[model samples]
Target: MDLTLAQEAGGSSLLSLLPFLIILLLFVPLFLNGRKQRRQMQETQAMQSALEDGDVVITTSGLRGTIVDASYEDTIDLEIADGVVTTWLRVAIREKVAPDTTSEDDSADSSGSTGTSESKPTIH
Candidate 1:
């Protein structure tokens, strides 16, 4: 009976630690998911920065456009549709188009003028 009592004490002590262990296990996956999301954001930013004129990009708001121009000031000009031109800051641009397709071949042709250091034009 004395040995059985000692064993019961040890079992309860181990059971007391189980909740803490379960909480730690749950947190581990959340931490790893956050890391993965951060990495994806960095990758997306890098891709956005690589955007140039003629690269088709989709905005965060789901506005698809071809990048008509890119500048050092973190802004770009987009032509969302035929005869439509708009200027948006870099943060507004989202996904980039797949490479190797020429923007010249795109049937949705829109005309736009590139902004310069000396001029700011009204964009649609």
Candidate 2:
């Protein structure tokens, strides 16, 4: 009888704490995701503020261009083509283009003749 009473007491205590545990589980992920999004927004703002002329960048709209003038506080002129410049909001710029770093050896291996007997099948 005493063991059954103890078990009931323990079960009630766990039930009392269940709501708090559920709330904690639900809020933890939301708080962590909000923090991560805030950090990403700060990083994007810093990148936008650091833009300068001659930097190659892509916009959020997927337009690729080179910065021709960034003298304005909130706008920049981008040269998308030869002698064609367009103004865009600084916030529209997504990220600076990274330089291609393909090594000469890799290019030569792909393009050079490998003294193999197997020839590429020609399509008529």
Candidate 3:
């Protein structure tokens, strides 16, 4: 008539917390996902803002280029390698490349054909 009352009180007290605990469990992932998404968006924005002229960049299409311009409207002009210029949306840039790094050695090829036929038959 004394110790039994304390045990019964403890058991009933824990029941009230069950629903709150379940709600917390369900919301945890959703909260974490939202925070992660927000961080990703901020990172994207920072990357976009850092774009500058002469900065080599890779587009989402796997195309590589140097950034000729970046606009607030979320678009940029890319100078692909040398002499190939193209316009792209800011979101299309997947990565940035250092401007000084280039595989095409300027000394090895001087005025070479850019994948286009320039041969003209000699008229005898």
Candidate 4:
């Protein structure tokens, strides 16, 4: 008997695996993407649940406000402006907004240079 049978057997096995390997490569990225999306959603939910009063946040609708009350199970009270409190679902919150530290420093510097009429107005 010739040893050609063994050589042909190995080649056929590799050829059979090609389609499976291609499928695996195709699905790996999708699996990783789904897992990443799930992790991000979990982080968002955790941040929303950890919300506290006085934390500034922005809503999905692009509304920025300070958290007035977060003790409610499903609702939160937000103050968008002075004396403008509104109740919204906790899930509606998009993310926490960091306070602008640079703006405060810029405002102070701009305030001192206010003698010129061309000086821009400083916002509190």
Candidate 5:
């Protein structure tokens, strides 16, 4: 029953490695998720640093504004409303808001052809 004892030893070896394999499986996804998050953060930082005047953006807190000035080292002037400019940290800017791509005719058509037009005031 020397053969039986050898078979039992091999089974035990496999069982001993089971816990290590489970732990490895658990850590792999966490490692990959962290790497992905770090890469995204880097991309966000790059976007923030490259911001310029007139670029509309949204903040982390859901405030939408236009970039009035980006000359400061760590802060930016965000005009949230006409004559209502606010200063914010550059890092607070979440993402640049894309301009509406529809043409004026398409927009007018969608609005049911309102004869009146309202011009938005600039922050200056």
Candidate 6:
């Protein structure tokens, strides 16, 4: 009789913990994702604040340019072309562009064969 009561008590204890376990499983991922997003936002803010003249950057709108002036408090002058400078908000800058690798990629692409593998269906 004591063994039966112990088993029943153990099963009830586990059932009581089941809801807590389910809630923990559901919230842990959300909490982690929020932390990750906050970290990314901090990194982006740091990058924007660290901008200076002569840094080559690409804008959020896909415009690639060099930073000609960044002395303003909330904006920067980007030289997109010779004698063509544009004023953009500091937040518009996405990231600094890496050194040119277009030529290398172009050479590799041209050396490979460009072909299609589609075949026409045969009529019986």
lDDT of each: 0.83, 0.90, 0.79, 0.91, 0.91, 0.90
Q: Poorest 10 consecutive residues of model 1 by lDDT? A: 107-116
The model with the greater lDDT, 1 or 2, is 2
Off by over 4 Å in 2: 100-124
Q: For residues 1-124, what per-residue lDDT tens digits would candidate 6 score against the true structure?
A: 9999999999999999999999999999999999999999899989999999988899999999989999998999999989999999999988987556655777866676667554558743
Across 1-124, the per-residue lDDT of candidate 2 in tens digits comes to 9999999999999999999999999999999999999999999999999999888899999999989999999999999989999999999998888645335556865876777665678743
Among residues 3 or more apart in sequence or in different chains, the pairs in candidate 6 whose N, CA or C atoms overlap within 3 Å are none
**lDDT comparing candidate 2 with the true structure:** 0.90
Off by over 4 Å in 6: 99-124
Better candidate by lDDT, 2 or 4: 4
Per-residue C-alpha lDDT of model 4 across residues 1-124, encoded as one tens digit per residue: 4589989999999999999999999999999999999999999999999999999999999998999999999999999999999999999999997768646877877787667565567754
Identify the candidate with maximal TM-score: 5
- Give residue 87's lDDT in candidate 5 (0 to 100): 98
lDDT of 3 by residue, 25-115 (tens): 9999999999999998889778877888878788878987777777657788988756777888888887776544455555434557577
- Model 1 over residues 33-96: C-alpha lDDT tens digits? 9999999999988987888898888898988888887975688999988978899989887788
TM-score of candidate 6 relative to the true fold: 0.75
Q: How do all models score by TM-score?
A: 0.74, 0.78, 0.64, 0.76, 0.82, 0.75
Please give the RMSD to the true structure for each candidate, in Å: 11.4, 5.8, 9.1, 3.9, 5.2, 8.6
Clashes of each: 0, 0, 0, 0, 0, 0
Q: Give the distance in Å from residue 86's predicted Cα in candidate 5 to where it truly belongs.
A: 0.8
Error of 5 at 74 (Å): 0.4
